[model samples]
Target: MKTLISGGTVVSLDPSIGDLARGDVLVDNGLITEVAAHIDAPDAEVIDACDRIVMPGFVDNHRHAWQTAFRGIGSDWTFPQWAAAMHGTVKAHYTPEDVYIGTLLGRLEALHSGVTTMLDWYHVAQTHEHEDAAIDALTDAPGRSVFCLGAGWGGGDSVDDDIRRVRARLSGGGRIDLALGMRGPGATGIDTAAREVKLADELGLRISLHIEAPGVITALHEHGLLRDTLTGVHANGIGEDELRLLADAGGSLSISPDVELKMGFGAPMTGVALAAGLRPTLSIDDVPSVGGDMFSTMRTAFAAQRGIDGGLRSRDLLDFATVDAAASMGLRDRTGSLTPGKDADIVLLRTDDVTIFPVTDPAASIVSHGHPGLVDTVLAAGRVVKRDGALVGVDLPALRTRLLASRDRIAEAAGVPLDGTWRPQP
Candidate 1:
């Protein structure tokens, strides 16, 4: 199987190859084979990219895909308030089928919006059935994903067994990866955290933790458990010392600027990440609190960082959403760039639209104003998952119906209206 994306402005994101004003990308059997100014391949199927901006698909390193059914539910709440609602009431109402629908909805939406790779920080896998259901939905969807498992609520070493069981169940070497969506030292104390990290090492899996408070990195350092496989999600208030420690240990961060600012998690660490010697990665965090597309992630990180000190450029911010994000998610080699030898995770954004005319700047235009609707073609692992602005092989009506039903059911069970202001219980 072969695909030739001909004559598009390619943002290779690789410094050595550089950006191409007009280039062709060739994909063969799920891998990128050639990228040049022009390619002549009559045997391959040609996709016209004359009026598009061809680039690598976005990578969202941290998102609760299983919470997609609660989209926009806690938009007005603080981090603590949202946590109360989610951990206090809503999650208990989730059924296994609900998890399936939610995961499917999130992954499909991500693909449609040109996010070829995502790390699903699924913390609500309440049961064995729910875990299986979430993984099943993720596999069924058309995108690369990491199923980062977690212990439902409170910190416990009990989830180590769950991770071992689930990891063994998953077939190795595929689009879906298994990781530990851990409570970390923030929720679980250092002793338990040490145990969790050891377990992750034994299983040979990565760990993505919510770094909500200070001392978490310190705890990991004390235990000598920090490693490259550890990724801190939404690292809001950690100071330079913690950042340095993380960077020294080869750790990474996934910052959701939109969620951090709105939920009062403190300013995003985009500028700080750079200062502390770590390449920052952007994420949606959760659709219930922020927009799902990488465009929003890029712009939000840029604006928020600039609002503080004013340094990040559009090209640098674009890297946050693409290559940096892929590296943070531990998927740097498989995807993240239009370079040959990587998977064909690509997106073609239509540049002829009124919002993006003149063709002055590619990276700036994309980072500032690119959106899901502007995405015309998407390929994940050389498969055309989306074409002509619509998702391929997806039953829209059925998926929509399932999503709505799941949302309503969970909301009703929690004694909350699907559409109204949430009132906190005294």
Candidate 2:
């Protein structure tokens, strides 16, 4: 099927031509066929894009998809305390049903906010049933995702069982891509990291690591596990040398500014990573604390970068949410920019929104004034997932109730009341 987007300000994101005003976009067979001033497709469905900011759909590079059920369950907790409570609960209490509800909520949220593609950094597979439940949730959603499958933090029989499930999922050849999600050197050492990376390489899959500190990469490199297949998350502590090694080794980094700030992980060096020949992208990290909106990540990243280095232009942050973000997800060839022959993952921003009224600059408007509510339309793989800021084909209220019930069960198992916070009194 072919569709033509008529007469809108297209942020083509194509470096060759850049942004165009009063442009036309054409989509055929789930890919952008053309993006020019005036296109003629006689048999295609035409849609008006008047006063819309048509750009590439946002890509959230790193996400804990199962955390959606506990969105507001970790408030007022420090990083250590929050992880102990929230992460521990997932390992001990989350059932297969919990995985299903949590992932569904998270995926639907991404669709609503114009995030067409996501990296589901799933690390809570306690049983084969749990793995099945997580995949079921993603399969039900409209957005695309890479399932970074892993065992629950229990780390013994759980890891072995999760690996078997991962193998089965890969063998099935479904929409889910199999990637290794490790707990890093702190939780698992260099030997374990190498084993996981090797498994991914053998299967031609990419591996994502949580680089909470510089030591994680150092340990991986020391053990000869750092390579193109490895991508680091929260690369805030790495210095110049470590950054170069990552760039040289063809590894990518995802800087989730909001989670980094809230957890006191220190300032993100996204600029420095880019300067060192790495276009380190950004992500929302997890829902609830950071919210599942890439716009929030873009805003926080831009403000943090500028606040640290004194100031920056607006286009700087847009790249983090679009092209740079796609690079982080290893999807530079599939989506990211509204380039011809790429997936038609597009986001139409309602520039006429009151919050962004008196718009000064288009790029600046996105970073400083834009929010999820301003996302007017979203298209993923040539299908309209959201129109006029409403999710299609999903009962959001019912999903929310399921998620809350799952949260209550988890809180009961953890022997704590999840009113609003996960921090237990010391």
Candidate 3:
């Protein structure tokens, strides 16, 4: 089947080239068939893209799918408190059913917000049943995802068994990509982290590690573990030397700016990383803590950079959430750019929206004033997952209700009330 998205202002987002104006795109069997002006296909279903800005769908590089059920769990807590409460709650009350519902809800939000792809850092899979439940939920969602399979939360010495079990059950099939989530400095010591990273390498799987605390990248560099397939998540404290090592190794970095600022990890993100040849991406770290809004992520990262460094261009911020982010997830070829032969993972923004009105510049308006409501349509792999800012193929109301009940239960099990607050004593 062929689909034509014609007469839209296309932002190609191709790193090799730049945005295009008054463009048309064609999709055939889920891949972008062609991208240009005045393309003609006789047998194609056409979508009117007039007055819309068609660009690559946002790619969220880091999110906890399990936290979808806990959208407002620690809204009023400090970083430490939030961490403690999240750990306590998830450990006690998150069942496999909860995992399924949460992941489905999270992916639904992604589709609704024009995020065609998400790298779900799901570390709450405590059993085979739990793993299957999460996978089932992702498959149910219309959008694509990278399930970064992980062991139970916190430090562990012997994860090889868990890794093998998850791989045996989940991998060797191409539907959902699997990356091992190597616990970062906050969760594990240097030695344990090295073991997890090496294990991922031995298995020939992509690896993602959190770099919350100091010297995490240095530790990885010392062990020669940084590589093309390794993605460092939330490298808020990484320095120039460490970033150089990351770029040299051909690895990638993802920054969850809102989460970082909320947790007081750092001000702004790794512009230094970009300067040193590493273009850091953006993400919604958790849904409950912060809603799943990639535009918000882009804006926060953009403002933080300019606030810290005096000024930053709008194009750079857009890249952080689009092509650069896709590259960080190793999905640049498939979904980042509005290029021919790529997946039709596209988003259409209404330039005439209130916040976006009087658009001085198209890209500038997107960075400064873009929001989810302005996303008129969203397509993932040529499939219309959302249109008019509402999700399709899923009952969002039911999902929201189910998740709210689960959150209350989780909080009750954690010995806390349903009110949104948390903080660990430092």
The top-ranked prediction according to TM-score is 1
**Each prediction's Cα lDDT score?**
0.87, 0.79, 0.79
Lowest lDDT sum, 10 consecutive residues, model 1, at 417-426
Residue lDDT tens for model 2, 1-426 = 999988878887788768886898999999999999999999999878987888889888788888887776554556776667666545578899998998888888887888898888887756678888888888889867888876555252224346555667667665566677776766776566666777777667777778777777777777777887677888787887888788888898888888888878888877778777777687877765667788778888888887778555677677877787777667888898999989999988887889887656777787888888989888898898888788877887888788889888887777877666346442
Q: Provide the TM-score for each candidate, comma-separated.
A: 0.98, 0.94, 0.94
Judged by whole-model lDDT over C-alpha atoms, candidate 1 comes out at 0.87
Residue by residue across 224-303, what tens digits does model 3's lDDT show?
Answer: 76778888887776677777888899998888888788877777456777776888888888866776888888888888
Best by lDDT: 1
Query: lDDT per residue, candidate 1, 56-107, as tens digits?
Result: 9999888888888889887887887778888788889999999999999998
Q: Between 1 and 3, whose TM-score is larger?
A: 1
Worst 10 residues of 3 by lDDT: 417-426
Candidate 1, pairs of clashing residues = none
Root-mean-square deviation of every model: 1.2, 2.0, 2.0
CA error at residue 100 for candidate 1, angstroms: 0.5
**Model 3 ranges with Cα > 4 A deviation:** 15-17, 172-174, 185-191, 420-426
